[model samples]
Target chain A: MEQILANGLYLGAQYALIALGLTLIFSLMNVLNFAHGQMYVFGGFVTYTVVAQLGLPFIVGLIASAVVLAVMGALIEKFLFRPVIRKSKRDESTMLLAAGIAFFLDAVILLLFGEKQRGVPKVVNGVFNWDMRLIMPYDRILIAALAVALIVGFILFMQYSRTGRAMRALAQDRVAAQLMGVDVDRYSMIGFALGAMLAGLVGGLLVTITGINLGMGGPTSVKAFLMIMIGGAGVISGAIAGGFILGMMESVGLTLLAAYGDVTYLVIFVTLMIFLAIRPQGLMGKPWG
Target chain B: MTDQTQTTPIVKGSAMSMNRVLGVGAFLLGVFVLVPVIINLTGRWDFYYTLTSVALLSVAAAGVWLTFYIGRINIGQGAYALTGGYVSAVLMTQYGVSFWLTLPLAGIFCALVSVLIGLPILRLRGVYFAMVTLVLTEVARLTALALPITNGAKGITSIPLPGELSILGLTIIPDFATLENPKLAFYLMAALLMVLTYLVLWRIVNSRLGHLCRSLQQNEELSASIGVNTAMLRVLSYAISSFFGGLAGAIFVAISQSIYPSSFVVQDSVNFMLYCFLGGLGYVFGPMLGTLLLYFGWDLLSVAKEYQLLIYSGALIALMLVLPNGILSLLDKKGGNK
Candidate 1:
């Protein structure tokens, strides 16, 4: 149980950061942003290029990934997302459109990076001894701290900052927010950029622990999807809670089910299905109707 | 969605007839027939599996079409195909069921298994549904790998091809009187695809069921208010899709004569989606076109396996960006809008 708890928290940190981005986009855009996973992959690639290829400092790579993805998010908003929003294409169509972009982006990355699994060098390597019997990676400890800090910081911004309030306003009622002079497009761009940056941050943290690879995005995207479903979309707390729940479920699943390493994914999806059937609004989601 | 705009009636009675359908079907049948003959005639038996691969891959593509027509994407088709292939291979090799008997049984098993997966998964909406399907396929893969029955990672092989059948001690194997050889398995596959396509789609698309499904696609709220049980219809769509997906897998096993879990990976599912997307979604004929072109292109690209993924991804990106709808959408530009 201790091992499961330890593993779950470490895994959960990654989930929370990625899910935060997914939920933010869902709340404001009404789309799942399927390419968010690809964005995560892009984050890994950026970090790898800076730290590994360019021989830059680890901090420089981490910061550069967030900044670069922020720009990519803006571009996505301006080009890919703008048309979907403007047309008010059915929400389903928008999701498909985003998926198409993700598919294309993943392909491009595969072409550019190849499919080999490459691990980013661990920035900090130490084991924190809790009990005399158990130890955990210091990298994991850092990830957990960063995730919590980011979540708190995001909540504070949403509650207090003028731009954050504008984002909230746009999410709640786009037309009314527009009437109140909250530039909807600008707010959406802000939401998207923030989402990308957070996803990039997770990607950076992930590579430091696991590795960088093009195929990572596909499963990671599904995990984010499951997290949003469980926690309910558009709510920051929901994203965090959902992410941890998913991570815990996966970790427990791995320990209990010896033969299936990918059991985490299957269990998460099945859980999502049950949750959606019982409460489509999610654990914390408000009913759109 | 763009194709939804191209509903202008063209040659309504003449072009859409069962007779025309048969004619087009026969022409397609003839092409499959001619290919192998040309191969045999040219004395290139080494290339036979290539043609077989195309025909078999079409079955998976057709499976994609079933859900796609209803405006849902089932990324798990490869899982279903793998399920059928594995089941058929196992039943044949271990239990010694004749290859022919095992084939249909595989299809039946896949349909039943899909129901189990679909029951929980069908609840997800749109992108969520796609996500869940993706997850389920991966689950299917991992489960297959973990199972002792599958021999774990090693996989099962040497599935014996059933010998010629006899009814009451009389040979059921008719002599190859002319062009219809026993290798006419390709023709059998083509025929099954056409029949399944017609029965599952042409019939549904022309019926009240089609109206309900399309209505759900167009406006879920309005459809529900108007007495459509949207959830039930969606489940029905998935079930039907699974049926064909299983059938495709069965046919694939029959043609290939062996099965492995790796044959139906997540990447293959994505490729199947690429086939459907490239051909055009929501059209009965779309997957057919997409399968033929994409696989044909894949075969051509095999020489450069290292660069194939790059080119494949690049092409997919280019296609989706240039034609969000699909290649068939270009049919409109050709003034065949009718």
Candidate 2:
């Protein structure tokens, strides 16, 4: 039970970070950002190239990933999403554009990073054994601590920062914020960049543990969608709660249903479908918001 | 300047006319008679396979288009396609059922399953519905992997070709295996299905049901207040949409004589919506034209080799940006001028 709890907590921290970026962009632009998983994978590759190929320190590699992804996200919003949303009559047109960008990124990632899985040298090396009841690597413990710190830092930034307040207003009501002198376009771009940066940070942090590959992009995006849906779409606290709930479910399901093979995800997906049917707005989200 | 009253007559008569009849006749002649003759002269027999696949893909895209018609972004058509393939494969190989018998059975099964799934999810807001449906293809894949009757990871293979399809005492279609060139036969079969699918779609769009669906698309709350059975319409369209997807999948399995969990993945589902978007979401035949253009365009880009996907995706993004309403919208503008 202690082992499962530890595993869930570690998984929850990372999963929450991934969900945070996606929900942020969704709230700001009402675009689902299908390329989010690709952005995450791109971040992992940036970190890999920096640390493994260039022989740079891991911290520098992590910063490089965040910077690269933020720029990409900003440019995509300005050039692709913003213009498309403005010109198109239908709102769903953005979904097509996002999916196209996802394909474009997947192709780009393949060409640049290749198809093989990549990992960096571990930052720390030692197994933490606690009374033989729970075992975890020291690297995992550090990554989890860093992830929790980042989440707390993000919440603080959103709560107190000037730019964060403007973004919150824009998300709450775009026209109202515009009327109140908020720069709608600029803030939207920033929100997208910030969301993407979070994805990159998580990718870079987890690269040492799970490694990264080209194929992980689609599944990662799907899992992130599931997280956001469970927590309530576009809600920060809900994302964190959904993340921990999913992490706990996964940990427990995997261990208990070990003899039954890979039925955990199937059950979880069905349950999510039923849960969404019962509560379309999610646990914390407003209807259609 | 023309008055509004004069334009109404033109708009009403536009649905049927001598010019429209001739245009459709030309299109039919071009597809059925001219293409095969050109392929024979060029000796590019493989073009048959490419066109057949396009025809089948467009059928599924038509289903996606229907959901879009009802104001839903359906990224779950692949699930129905996969389910249909598995149903047909399992029945033909395991239950000793004939291929012809399993085709409608697959479609009906998919329709039934979709109704069960769509009832609850369809009630959500469009955005929430989109998000929920997005995971459905993955869920279908996982279910396929876990289910024992699906033959697990190996998938069902080596299924027999579609046998002779007949009605009463007449043999309408001969067994595919006995044909001299099954490629041509498969192409004809798929083309026939495509034409039939679009005709039905065109009919539906012109009917009273289609008007209610359009109202739902425009404003669901207003439509519901005005006495529309909004829930039933949504679910009915969804069922019909999944039926088309299932039929397409069943035909696809017959063409390849195999079924696998990975056969219809999430990319294919997204591409179906892309087809509708590329052609023109408002038009009935949009998906057919979109599928033809995309499939051929991809084939043409094969010469790019390593940069093929990069170029293809880049072109797709550019095209969506340039033609936000779709390629057919350009035609609509020119047609409206008259």
Candidate 3:
């Protein structure tokens, strides 16, 4: 039980970061950025290339990943999403554009990073073992700590910073924010960049422990979607809660249903579908928000 | 929402005008008669496989398009397709049922399954519905992997070809095994199904049900206030949409003689939506044209080798930017106003 708790906490920290980025994008643009996972994978590859290939420091690699992804996110918003959203009558049309960008990023990732699974060398070299009941690597602990720190920082930024406040206002009501003199286009880009940076930060942090691969992009996006759905779409606090809940469920499910093999995910997915059916608004989100 | 001014004009006019009949007849003649003759002259038998695939894919895309008609961004059509394939495969391989019998059975099963799934999620807002449907393909894949009857990861394989159809000892259709060229046989079967699927789709879009569905698309609340059964309409369209997906999948399995969990993945589902968007969501035949263009475009890009996907995606993005209303929108006199 202690081990499960520890594992869940670790997973929750990382999962929350991913969900945060996705929910952030959804709230800001009202576009479910399908390429968010590809961005995460791209971040992982950036970190891998920096720390492992170029022999850069782990901190440098992480920062580089965030910076690169922020730029990419900003450019995509300005060029692809912004114009498409402005011109297209159907709001759902962005989904096609998002899917296209996902494919583009995926192809780019494959060509640049290749299909091999890659991991950076561990920054710390110790295993934290407690009474033979719980075991985790020190790198995992460090990554989890960093993830938590980033989440807190993000929350604080959203609460206190000018740009963050403008973004929050934009998410709350786009027209109202515009009427309030918020530069909708500029802030939308910034929010997208910040969201993508969160994905990158989480990806870079977790690469040392879990490794990264080309195929992980789609599954990662789906997992993030599950987390957000569990909590509530576009609800920041809901994303955090959903992440921890999903992490706990996964940890417990995987451990208990080990003998059953792959049934854990199937059960989780079906449960999510049922849960959405029961409460379309989710745990924290307003109905149709 | 402000951009909703550019409404897709409710398809109006004589249902069967002389010009429309002639145009459709000529198109059918080209598909059924000219294409096979051209393939024979060119001696490119592989074109049959490619065209058959396009036909099958467009059938599934038609279902996706129907959901779009009702204002839902469906990304789960692949789940129905996969389920349909498995249903047909399992019945044919394990129960010793004829493939001919499994086709409609597969579609009916998917329609039933979709009603159950759509009942709840269809009430959610568009994006919520879209997100929920997005996970469904993966869920279907996992279910396929976990279920014992599906043969797990190995999948059901080497299923026999579709047998003859007969009534009262009078043969209506000969067995596929007895055909001289199964490729040609599959192509014709797929084309026939495609034609039938579109006919039904056209009929639905022109019918009163389709009009009510369009109202749901425009404003569900207003429609509901005006005495439309919004929930029933949504679920009904979704069921019909999924039925088409199932039909496509059943035929696909028959052609391949196999069914695998990985046969229809999330990418294929996304591509189904892409086909709708590419062709023009406003038109009934949009998905068909979109599937043909995208499929042939991808085949043409095979020479690009490693850069094929990059080019394809780039082109897709550029095209979406240029023609947000889709390729058919280009034909509109006012350009997207229709």
Candidate 4:
């Protein structure tokens, strides 16, 4: 039971970061980036390379991953995404373009890193004993804490920062934002970069546990999308609620169901279908204007 | 969405008359019919498998194109294909059903299943539908793995080829077991199926229902407001798409001689969509052209060994950016739009 709780929260936190990034972009630009998970993997590998291979400090690696990935994300937005957007074919090729980019990233990673996963050393090695029975790794607790902190920091930024206000305005009304003299192009780049940066931060932090699996992109992307959907797309609080809910559900399902663990995805898939059928706008996502 | 504004002239049959189209189709049919013979004569019979696979894949892609026509992207056709493969396999192996009978039965079964699944999900537009379908193949694979009837992950194996075409042991058509190059027969069979699949699509596109479908693509709200049953149309298109997908899967099982949980993965589902896009989603024959080029393109890239996937990805991204309408759009300036 304790293991389930810990794992669930840990998974939820990781998913929270990824889902937040996805929702961030969706709210700002309405682009459902299919390649976000690939960037996550790429970011994790960047941290692994910087810290484990180059013998750099973990903090330095995290910062470096964030910066490098933010740059890559911006470049991708400018070249791949912006062109498709400029053509006014946003919905058509967004999925395919992101998927193509994801595939490209997968191939690049496969060629450069090979198929084997490279494990990263724990960020901190300690144990937290609780209630004389439940015990958890301090590394896990740290990872989870860092995830929470980043998320809280992000919420505050969105609440207080000028860019955050601009993004929220854009999300609410694009034409209005443009009329208000907000630079949609520049903010889109920032939104995308910020989204990628969050994915990178989570990827870098979770390297202690996830290590680095090249094939993680597909499943990761799906789960993140699921979180956003469940939380209601276009809402920050919705993303958080959805991510934690999914995390707990997955944990409880794995623990209680045991032999029926795989059924969890089937359940998720069916639930999403039902939810979309009955509530197309989602709980928090107002129909896009 | 880009194609939504542009006219679908080719599929509407605005440019080519029936005679020219049929004449071109007949010439292509003759070429497919002769491919196996040429391979046999030269003794390079292995290409028949590649040809057959491409043909079957085109059938699946055509199904995806139908959904694309209705303004919905289907990334879960693999589920129907995989289900179709299993249905035919089970019917043939356990129930002693005729291989010929299972093919259309599989299509019907998949159509029914798709209708059941689509009725609810079709209400959601755009990426939501695509997202739901994207996970469907995975869900299907998992279901196949968990179900006792599917025989777990080991999967059903040794599926017999379509029973011999014979009368009182006097063979009019040779069985796969006895043929020197059974792939030739498979190629011809697949080609015939492809021809029939497109013929049905052709008939549909020329019909009133096809015009309604095109209208939905161009403007869903306008059509819906005009009393067009957009929801029912979307479901119908999806059902037909899955029917084709299932048919292709059934044929694939006959050729592979087995069905597994991993028989058709999510990647194959994505590839089906890509084929439609790469072919010119606007054209009915686009997937046929796209599938041929991509199937061969993959083989040609095998020489690169490890870098094959990298090059493939590059090609896909570049292809989308440079020729978003698909390579077939390059055939004419007025937008292949078929």
- Candidate 2 per-residue C-alpha lDDT over B17-89 given as tens digits, one digit per residue, 9 for 90 to 100: 6566787899889889998999999999989999999999999999999999889999999999999999999
**DockQ, each predicted model:** 0.30, 0.74, 0.80, 0.57
What docking class should model 3 receive? Answer: medium
**Candidate 2 docking classification:** medium
Each prediction's TM-score against the native? 0.85, 0.97, 0.97, 0.93
Q: Rate the local accuracy (lDDT) of all candidates.
A: 0.73, 0.90, 0.91, 0.84
TM-score computed on alpha carbons, candidate 3: 0.97
Best by lDDT: 3
Pairs clashing within candidate 2: none
Better of 1 and 4 by TM-score: 4
Ranking by lDDT: 3, 2, 4, 1
lDDT of 4 by residue, B237-285 (tens): 9999999999999999999999999999888998898788788877788
Which scores greater on DockQ, model 2 or model 4?
A: 2
Which residue pairs clash within candidate 3? Answer: none
Error of 3 at B32 (Å): 0.5
Q: After superposition, which runs of candidate 2 have C-alpha atoms over 4 Å from their true positions? A: B1-16, B335-338
Q: Write candidate 3's Cα lDDT for A1-289 as tens digits.
A: 8999999999999999999999999999998989989999999999999999999899999999999999999999999999999888788889889899999999999999999999999999999999899999899999999999999999999999998899999999999999999999999999999999998988899898899999999989888988888999899999999998999999999999899987998889888888888898889987865
Residue A54, model 1: Cα distance from true site in angstroms: 3.5
Error of 1 at A45 (Å): 3.0
Local accuracy of candidate 4 as per-residue lDDT tens digits, A80-117:
88787665333676666777888899999898778888
Residue A68 in candidate 1, Cα distance off native in Å: 1.7
Worst 10 residues of 3 chain B by lDDT: B1-10
Model 2, A157-221: lDDT tens per residue? 99999999999999899999999999999999999999999999988998988999999999889
